[model samples]
Target: MVSISDYGDFYKMAKRNIMLAILGFNAQKHFCDTRERMVSNVLSSLHKLVAVDPHSPLNFREVYTTELFGLSLIQNLGEDVCSVYVEEFGREISKEEIFHVLVHEILSCVVEPDWRDYFPYLSWLPNKSFETIVSSTEFRRDAVMNALIKRQKERIARGEARISYIDFLLEAKNSTQLTDHQLMLLLAESIAAAVDTVLEWLYREIREVCGGKAVTEEDLPRLPYLDAVLHETLRLHSPVPVLPTRFVHDDTTLAGYDVPAGTQVMINVFGCHMDEEAWESPGEWSPERFLGEGFKLADRYKTLAFGAGRRTCAGSQQAVSIACVAIARFVQELQWTLREGDGDKEDTMQYTALKLHPLHVHLKPRGS
Candidate 1:
């Protein structure tokens, strides 16, 4: 049940570097290429919409996009992590099902009343109920990780190795000094780190930049506006509004105040992104802010969407590549209009920010 956060500083640094190498450009390029092929397959089925009666609007809602993008993300990650496709009851597991369980369990832990928050001196008290709930959730999460890791070990024993996170970890098992439990937790953390939308201006950008051809990763450099749209979307609605808590092992000072050792600190991503000091008209959705010459991608701390510093998200590049290409392709092929009455739905947050009501949209083939 130990997470990467529980590791010593050296172990944490080593683990992060391994993740960085696994999720670096070269690996991401391969993952993105695989995802694009999968996306093309999915889009192929949707292409029939071109011939659907122009007067009819296709009902594209949360369920549809969740499957489209979620499946793509998890399947690609699954392959890259262990060369396995996760399934249950002989069918592929849906992203909604996985998140529904994981998020609920996680949120339960976050909201559940705990005495430690009120009485640090009484922290020695046993909280059996909380412990039981956490244990159950960990079991569920670990089952998948164990299965994947076991399969990779079997593959390695058979001398059928592939370049993947699990394969890499299995090969370095002894040298890295990571016990099976730590390795599983590290892999789980990496998976968690790897876990996108905007359309209007994007539609215009794709049409202008890509023309009749579907957009590719090569087109990303030419579509600054599209990148702006993505950044703005994240700024306005970060997936993880609150970052994972960081434990302070040694007392430190921040801005002005002292943070004692053993302190758990959480960064408010939503607040940082909306800071008036850092952004003009902070409350408004303006992608142009990111388009300025001052904004440099090399500055990792510029925005906290993917986090900052040595622990910045390992999958940031992979996420951007996948999202940019997928979005461009969708815009290039389909026209999206928010469905009637769905615009007023406020966002809700759990493990990530989500729509209070599912986003329903009307879709028609582009140029129709």
Candidate 2:
């Protein structure tokens, strides 16, 4: 029941150290070296879905893409960072388990209100129902995480000699003064946190740019329009609609009238992205606004979808790379059109923004 401010310097230090390990140049290069295999596996899984009956409509919803994306991401992250292998799609039970624990169990608990948060003095008051639910969810989450750590430890005992984030944590356990439970939570947070599109114009762009060859990571730099499409999409449908709460250490005025030292603040990410003052016709889906010479890769952060500053997403660059390559490859191989009824569903938010209803779409091979 610790409040947001309860985290101490050691916690922050451990997180900083872990983030540096995961996001450093060599770690990023490892991710890059494995990108081709990851993308290939995803595309292969996708092909399986649409290739069935070839002309039939596919649901092509978030769940489907999530599977493709999650499996690929977990496979790379697990292999490179955890020394574990997540099965490919179809046999991707591990990926599904990870998502279930992360999105359903943990995220559900996150949005649940706790009486203690608003009234610390009432912390002793009985909260049996909430406590029961949270406890159950935590048990389930810890089960999954503990299993991964246990497997990693066995690898270490076997003298596998693999370098991974988990190995780093294990080695630093004594130096960091991190208890087993603390290490488990740190690994859980890392695993949980370590967790499209305009078609028509982009199809033409790919055809012109790649000339019928598949889009590769190298070609991403040349696809500025594709970059705009991604930026606009992120602006409209941010990764997280409301970021985690922040604790104010000193009194300060914010937006005219906020002056309290102990106040807890939260950013309404969706509101900021849709701010009329900042973006022209903010509700409109206009990729062209991001085009021309003003466009820079750094501009992708302008929406703050991945957060801003040092606390920004550690996997942001890796995220962009995977997304650009995936989108390009999809358009290069298939024709995509939204199903009639799905075109109007508003985006919904849980922990991340998602469609109120799953997106349904029709797809066909390009030559067909």
Candidate 3:
């Protein structure tokens, strides 16, 4: 189990690198002209969607993921590279895939872009029926890495130093020795685990907010109700409902029972979150419970969204920031209603290990 403190550095590094990438993308004049301009365009588009009609059909997740991914790529690779990359890969990009790619890029910037340098095993093609697809992916990734490395080398040779994620990783004077394969595995693991978990929370919050009145920048500060809703949703439907199993280091007594060392303990976080003793109307969707003195649904330590001890999530802050921004923008832009004849309640109450989303609903333009 990793504690929050242990992961603080990781969180800081991810946040810094991701933001830098966003800024870099926006600074490109050929495509965006200015960061503010690009942001304004997106914001304006969102507002237009919101004002046009309360029931217009809009895929919030699709638009949000595309924009976010586009921004990240623009920052890290510039307009030309981002354009080519998207043209080649965008059609294949699902929400989960976008999250995976973004997480990998961010992690590489912070830790080691040449992580595969240590783990050569990852570069080898495995003997599998889908080897062709796997090999193609590997080739594409290697091409990107080679391009980045060449750029760095050119800067060095020209006596012009550049500060980039890759540059920082290369400059780590004291680093643990890891094989190229291990480094690739580490990078892959970070991306796969972090992205989907964060997206699940993000999608849930955005859906909830978009279910109500339009949300705008002016309404941001006053949206405690929205914040409360997000908090309550997270508490009720944690992405990873089952905490990782912990092995006991020593024999101990628990609830008057003796347990031997080496025993594995599993905590049902989902069950605890819904315990009648812990929360009132445990199964209902009430954001009010998370506000002010009523915010006692569960103990902070017991909230297993971030886990506990040494193994807690390392990207909590980044995840929250992404979710908050996406949700706010979505609410500000789109107006929606339950499908006709479906009653007044939301039908997106189901949960799965993958994600939680609303059922099909028709939305027409508010005025048209």
lDDT of 2 by residue, 19-47 (tens): 55565557666656467666676567667
RMSD of each: 4.7, 4.9, 10.3
Candidate 1: the clashing residue pairs are none
Let me know the TM-score candidate 2 reaches against the reference structure: 0.84
> TM-score of predicted model 1?
0.80
| TM-score (C-alpha, index-matched) for candidate 3 | 0.54
For residues 1-368, write the lDDT of model 1, one tens digit per residue: 22235556655655555554466667665566566775686566556653565454454443344444443334323343313335433444445545544444655555566777678888999989878877887876666656666666776788876666676666677877778887777666555441014566777777788777888888899998888877887888887788878888999999999999999888989889888888777788877777778776753255688877666766677678877777777777777676677767787766567777667556677665
* Model 3 misplacement above 4 A: 1-56, 68-167, 193-223, 254-257, 296-302, 338-352, 356-368
- What clash pairs does model 2 have? none
Which of 1 and 2 is the better model by TM-score? 2
Backbone clash tally (model 2): 0
Worst lDDT run of 10 residues, candidate 1, spans 75-84
lDDT string for model 3 (119-197, tens) is 6668574445345445565554544444434555565567665443333333441363434443333333333341223
Residue 355 miss distance in model 3 (angstroms)? 4.0
Candidate 3: residue 260 lDDT (0-100): 100
Listed in order, each prediction's TM-score against the native is 0.80, 0.84, 0.54
Give the higher-TM-score candidate: 2 or 3: 2
